[model samples]
Target: MTSTARILIVEDEPKLVELLTLYLEAAGYACHAVYDGNHVDEALTSFKPDLMLLDLMLPGKDGLTICKELRQHSQLPVIMVTAKVEEIDRLLGLELGADDYLCKPYSPREVVARVKAVLRRYQPQAPAAASTTSGVHIDETRFLAQLDGVTLDLTPVEFRLFALMTHSPGQVFSRDQLLTLIYDDHRIVTDRTVDSHIKNLRKKLEAVRPEQEVIRSIYGVGYKFEEGSV
Candidate 1:
């Protein structure tokens, strides 16, 4: 885990924010707190948090709106906190790019655990050497991916997906196959989950190279890394 990772706590409840800060700080994470959604933008610019703990209901702006706006340009991890247990609310949070969420009346320790899980998914592990495939070079031991010598900020799932596809470029893989490869824990997930990750991965890659289509869709089949694109 990244000991220096900063966590921004955006909750109107002072007691809740205090509790969260205590737990996170004890876990070796830096914590910043904001009581209103209106201050989130300024806090983001000043604190430069690695993740955000956002509340659905806030004084100034709603968490959903903040999350939606944040996703426009940044992939900064966000874990939503809300009292609402509705399915639509959950789906909306996911659609707005929240990495995870905690329902109200949740344990503080559970919050810490969720934060750790999300960070683990994005934090790069130390890999000993780098391997080059096609135009992209991935250092598996270091958990790094580089496209045309530029680093790609891939989440763990994205890295695994890219690594698997690069292992045999041009080989088409079904969504089921990709899903199984990406997740070893056997967690229940839908095809849409796989598609969402793929979409995010494509966007991150395209940000660096707008013209290159590194990962190609196989129509009804699935997807494949374009060979010789490097």
Candidate 2:
């Protein structure tokens, strides 16, 4: 876990709030609690937390609305916390820009582990020195990526995927190979998860350079990055 990483908890339940705070604090995260969704904006400004644990149900404002509104201007890491385990709700939350989702009745340890996972993905430092090749530029120290001079608003997963593929062009990587490179934690994810993320990454890159196709799929095998494509 990243020591001193601040986590904002938005939940109306007092006991759950206390429990989450206690667990996160014990894991070296600074925790702040907000009972009402309406107060989230204010707390975000004041706390400037590294990540947000947003409860789907809240007084004054709902989590979906809060997340939707927050996505308008901020890319703050968000993990939706809720008792609603419906597939649609989970998909909606992801579409709304949530970094992760956790259902109620989950262990506090699991939450801590998840928190660590999200932060690790978002905060990974550059492995060697910063460099640029082709049309891509990356600053390891700053965790910055720029394509043809435009900075990409990539999610944690997107950023990791881009960095890994760009680091070694023309090398075919199976979905399993790419998954291991992307996530340090042992979280089980289907091949569709990797494909979905790749789709997103390709879209972002294409948005900046429509004529260039950087990643190519090797049917029945995996995918690879083409250095000369861009």
Candidate 3:
């Protein structure tokens, strides 16, 4: 069994914070709860949580600011909790480096599941023997994607999605499959989410290499990375 992971909960509401803490601890994970934005930096440095559950509206500093700040220093996974239903808010959080977001009135069990899923994706481990010889170079160390001297500045999600496709080029992945790969809790995602990310990834790739498109969209199925060429 995997060891218990450390988590930090940053929600201002005493009742909700306490509830989540209780649920997470019951799940056999180490958890720290903070009720203000002022303590976030200190908690991040000292607690060193594997993942953070941040609420958007907080006293002192807002969650978006904290998310942006954390991204500058660490790739520690973050899941934003917000009561806001605006799509703009959701897009802003994701664009600012949050791995996921949970709307208000969420189940503690669902939150726990999301946490586990995110950790599974972002946590690093020793590479498998076969992966080393797969001829697909995904340099986690450099946060870079390269093929025949071409390089791209892929977002964390984009990089992961690209790596998945490139590892087995020509293998088509349905929208549902891509959603599962990109999000820890696929239960909260939609097919349009996959479409948006793919569009973003394509735009980023096109910025770097104007002549080529590495990802291709199928009319009725999904997407596949073009194979047989660099």
lDDT computed for candidate 1: 0.80
Cα miss at 229, model 3 (Å)? 5.5
Q: Better model by TM-score, 1 or 3? A: 3
Two-way lDDT contest, 1 vs 2, winner: 2
Best by TM-score: 3
Ranking of predictions according to TM-score: 3, 2, 1
lDDT by residue (9-107, candidate 1, tens digit) is 999999988999999999999999999899999999999999999998999999989988987778788888878666434443255667665789888
Per-candidate TM-score against the hidden true structure: 0.61, 0.83, 0.85
Question: Worst 10-residue stretch by lDDT in candidate 1?
Answer: 87-96
lDDT to native, each model? 0.80, 0.82, 0.78
Tens digits of per-residue lDDT for model 3, 54-164: 998999899988988887767788888888657434564356667777888889999989888887776566653332312346776556676545676566787788888
For model 2, the local distance difference test gives: 0.82
Top candidate, metric lDDT:
2
